[model samples]
Target: MRTSSGAGELLVELHRDNGVPLHQQLESAIRTRIRAGLLRPETVMPSTRALAQDLGLSRGVIVEAYQQLVAEGYLISRGGGYTLVADIAVVSPTAAAKPGAGPPRIDFRYSRPDVSQFPRAAWLRSVRRVLNETPNRSLAYLDGRGTIELRTALSDYLNRVRGTAARPENMMICNGFAQGSRLILQVLAAQGHTRLAVEDPSDNDLREVAAAAGLETVGIPVLNSGIDVDALERSGADVVLVTAAHQFPTGAVTSADTRAALVAWAGQGNRLVIEDDYDAEYRYDREPVGAMQGLAPDRVAYAGTASKTLAPGLRLGWLILPSWLVEPMSQAKLMDDRGSPVLDQLAFADFVAHGEFDRHLRRMRPRYRELRDTLVERLAARVPELEPVGVSAGLHVLTWLPADLSEEALREAALARGLGVYGLKPYWVSGDGPAGLVFGYGSLSRQEVVEGIDLLAEVVAALRS
Candidate 1:
């Protein structure tokens, strides 16, 4: 074992007669230590001469190993400066897996899109166009309300497609739906709003955001048509968040009557509605429903994201605020990271303006619809006992299990078989709900969807036995 001491130490054990070259062995040892997080980012390494002297190897071998590590991004070198580990070093297999884990689980967790289908060429074109056309001054710290170009483009797109009354001046670009919701809740809390009414069994992550923003959350039941307005009114919440076009975990579109009642409920007091139109573009059975914000723009704060339609990693979302919120929300946004990335905002603006965004959705809608259809059909055929609940829109469907089966037991069995399935119990605020599972099919292929369902059926049969 040969070790070199410095601000960062290198430990290498070399085989004198092994076929591998000394340089190769030294490079491998350093790479492994960096990946295992033993050699942290920015830690300076010993001089090549010092390391060579310590290991009884030629200086040329140490230099070759250091150069190789630098080329591979495992190390960084500057002129006349000691080599240092790259700042991007991360623990890999250790962070992602246990010591003796089984094969990768087939993840069916909902709300993820097929990232492989991302429009790379189109996105590259948009980014290139932005870089070419955008003025240098425009790239500086921008308005917290986002770039005027994107807001203008989004204003037109939302108005034309979603029936929103969005204006360039009234919208703020955010990191994503999660951050958008947090900003809104923070504004509401600052405005003396105490209670936020959310749909029961809604996205638990959003509920946690509401709590973090200093607003107490109250759950209102979600009926087949939509959120129970009567219960919302009775809950005495000053603000409400809803997925009116297509509710999550249930796929219930809010009826016209309920939309009216909700707007009316907001009109009666100092109330507001936060509409998370997360995935309203993929309705296959009929034309998608228009946004609820159109009916009552003054009372509704609408939020839309590029996560489901384009890709989540983009972290791009926009909020169409009520006129009263425009100033406060923009201020809050300014205080929260000085707004999202200007380059992404500009590229997205160009993406939407050139109709690339529309074309992308046009291409993806049917693909997602097919995935949803296959999952529903397979569930109905192989495990008829599990009734598919919401299948009309969105990337996932919720299936209610038979009363005799246990959600926990079935989920554990599915995991043992390397299948990842989520249950509705965790989404409920009370943590008590009917037995059901949410199957997200957007990220899986047609054959994978079939195989997943087949495996699930086997698990069900075995559990019954």
Candidate 2:
């Protein structure tokens, strides 16, 4: 258990007592510190040597703990000799879906669902109803679009809850957001629009996915309010993708004025607006923000998913394209997966039609809000220098760490203590202020939230002192 010079002094509270296993306890402690907003994202973690020495444990134990987090996507490997709190939110819509066996670990990186609380019984019940009620032969390549029943239900629900527009015919049910996005790219490219204007700080993986599909993405500067319209226009890209509901890391809801500006641009210029309504549900402060698609259905393409609301494993998402893009995008989708799995689509339709889905959301939205509140209060108490962005809505909160505390040093300290935090640089095109760390409360229980944030504060103290 050799230590890293002066870094050996960093402290980690390892409770061998109490019934919990050391590995889980360590993981819990790390999670607590991260949520409390002490460890900024992208901060490098200490070597296992330093962690084992400081915690008075075998290096093997520290190594195993670190490996667990890395497997869970909370920690990333850097080149020379270090581990880091990797940006967990880098999602590529292009990546093929891989199967996960069971519940996801508390990843605090992506906007995910609470696995422990998912209404399995209700979903099963819906599955049973759909299985028995629907024709057996209907399951084979019936609608390239989503089930008519589901589309009808979504038409009313999305309009009521998210302010999405139009007749059920306007909505084309596809796979998840990634699949849907790919189809849209194909449609725009087919129409001879090869360039897309994307948010500078938007998902890197998503941009890369578009690029893979033969569309050149032009980066558009995103201000605290919304995308820089002037910069976007100058980019000369005819297509655009926006995570409007709660801007990814920054969590700024597209202002009403900005929404209007986007609407005007798409309306007058014939530009296509691909609206990734990221987390439109889960609003604690007030009414959930409305969708940009509703503002100009003819120009805006509305995409929503059950990934955040239900779970990503369901592989269920929807896209409502404008009239012009509909035929082309739908044609592209037919050639893609030919449409998502009929079984899952039918099950989801039953879930929504029977009102079981809404009930689930109603129950979980408040729980998520409470978790968010706990994270904010705890972070403020622990690290006064760290300021949080996007506390009002969304699953994660971004913390701006003090510039004096090197992100590298803080990350090392947090890793020594088994902490996880995502740095903001990954979200930027090109800019440097202080580091931005993302804290996701959706997957964590209220108790985990408290403990995670507290540990983070302790790590911050060790780094600076």
Candidate 3:
């Protein structure tokens, strides 16, 4: 059938001798196009007369097909008899599974804070204060380094709290760690740095980002203390990305000697270190360790985010660059989204300057500590076969399962019982490791943790039997 010139070129095929009616063929074709996303939502359809003339079909057939589609909710009939595609959800043909699948009842997913504890009243006050005091010019396009008020506030806060040597002029406020890491990797790649070394069992996102930036990634083994520096030196990588303060998925803090050796390694070849200091706010046992960036400010680029401290919804993060790399990174930031939202940055600045941020953290630290304790205690009492790894810091506890147990089987069994648990295998670059699971207690209550662990014990016993 010929395409109609009207309504953005409506094309349809009809079968007459094949025994299927012309109207039925038209309706099925249109429905298939809409379902396949070839016809977008709200797309106008050709009038019956025009389509019929183009296809050499009777007007009655076109009218019948249009009416049937409208009755089936695939098309919307509007004023003046115009038909438009309905704005219904489109299921992609390539999708592995359908969307809207509900999450498990008891989820132990990590990297999220207790959003219910967000200081709504305090944050509102800060935003309202910023709106009243900020000048009209402050709302316009700002420097890619972000608002000066926030940089100054963060410079002071990071220094005092994390013992970082950050300066207001050398920091860039980003959407979150996701953006900050990308910006840094892009800059490094542009500067002719080719190889990036990452922790063997670290977050897989790092490897993906490095590859996106056109750099080769090498996985360096992580010892109990931290990343294996000796292996890192032999890898010939010019830069390394590490979560030194608290390693992710396996929660091991870098020892002081290893930190020094890492700095020395960078110094020998003028290498750089990208430190992801996420979730350093909550330390249950004692005072948190000072940041490695503090030791070698010139060699380390430090990144911190509000995802773990405040809420992931905030999408707020900051990067403290070495003086030499500031200009390039600032230019990259300008090209990347023209800097983060200004009003949110100003509000966070006010939050920090007024000590509201500290007060909020003070209230959350103990609460998270209690949840971590409960998770560890219940797991120990019920499923003593699973051993808890990592220190008493951050939002998650990495647990090593019994050597005989299969991580994938346990995860599937737990999911079948309406409980969600994450396995540690996917985090490895090689995907060959021991059977382990990560237990995130951030968003869970004390009772949820107890119940989840008890259910996990049942699953483990059944698997063994």
Least well predicted 10-residue stretch by lDDT in candidate 2: 1-10
Error of 1 at 62 (Å): 11
Candidate 2's residue-wise lDDT over 1-465, tens digit each?
222223453345777788777877777666555454444467677878877777777888877887888887777776786777655444345456886543323235556568888799999998898888989776877556767778888888888888888567788887788788877887777778888888877677777778877898777877787888878777888888888888887787788888898888887665888899868777778667788888898999898888888888887888887777767776787788777777787788888978888899889878988988888888889886777887787788888777677666765566666565657776765554447677777888888778777777887777668
CA RMSD per model (angstroms): 7.3, 18.2, 7.2
lDDT of each: 0.89, 0.76, 0.90
Model 3 CA RMSD to the hidden true structure, in angstroms: 7.2
Q: List, residue by residue over 113-214, the lDDT tens digit for candidate 1.
A: 999999999999999999999899987888789999999999999999999999999999999988899988998999999999998878899788888889
Q: Which is the better candidate, 1 or 3, if ranked by TM-score?
A: 1
Off by over 4 Å in 2: 1-107, 431-434
Score candidate 2 by lDDT.
Answer: 0.76
lDDT of 2 at 192: 82
Worst 10 residues of 3 by lDDT: 1-10
Candidate 2 TM-score, true structure as reference = 0.75
Those runs of model 1 whose alpha carbons end farther than 4 Å from true positions after fitting are 1-104
TM-score of each: 0.83, 0.75, 0.80
